[model samples]
Target: MTGQLTVTVGKSDGRVTVLTLSGELDRDETHLLEEAGEAALASGIQLLVLDLRSVTFCDSSGLRTFVHLHRLATARGACLRLAELHPPVSTVVEVVNLDRMLSLHPTVADALIL
Candidate 1:
């Protein structure tokens, strides 16, 4: 069975916005994230942080969504950061070397500050 994905808008301060995600991220759920990302960009956010601490699983589709968001943010002159990645998500990221291409932080606080 596939897990349900939930995307919640956490905090928004000035130009920064946080989207907290939980559950599995796969091909079927990528659209949820993409929609949220587009909305953040449209709102004129300077930084978009994804708090992924609760994300239990992530596959290649999830990785692709990350890259898509990164590109979208870049085109809009916004920054995209991932924070508190769970082990499974981290492993997929490392395997694909996405860690080098995307901004990753140990926590949302770190992602916000640096």
Candidate 2:
């Protein structure tokens, strides 16, 4: 379904930048997701915690976007972690075996602790 991805950035104990992603993250919404991460880095946000609980769907493009952003964070000596993925999104994450390459937390709170 058509939807929007809203990114809200916050500070986690003055150490990391928490980027909470809400709404569906599909092909149509993936570009915004990529820009959100890049913007965080550009704004000096090192550590990134992506809360995906509100994301109802994520296609290959969305996953690819995440991977690209993850690499960007790594290059900047930062980390990009995901948390609170809905069941559908989580299933795709598992199907793609992204769990093996990326850290997935149960919740945004948990991601912050990582």
Q: Say which candidate scores most in TM-score.
A: 1
lDDT per residue for candidate 2 within 1-114, as digits (tens), equals 578878777564445878777888888888888887887776666578888878878888888988898889888888889988878999998999998888888977888764
- Which digits, one per residue and each the tens of the lDDT, describe model 1 over residues 56-98? 9898888999999999999999999999996999998999999
* CA lDDT of each prediction against the hidden true structure: 0.92, 0.81
Candidate 1 Cα misplacement greater than 4 A, ranges: none
- Indicate which candidate wins on lDDT: 1
Clashes of each: 0, 0
Clashing pairs in 1: none
Q: What are the RMSDs of all candidates, in order?
A: 1.1, 1.8
> What is the lDDT for 96 in model 2?
93
Estimate TM-scores for all models. 0.96, 0.88
Count of backbone collisions in candidate 2: 0
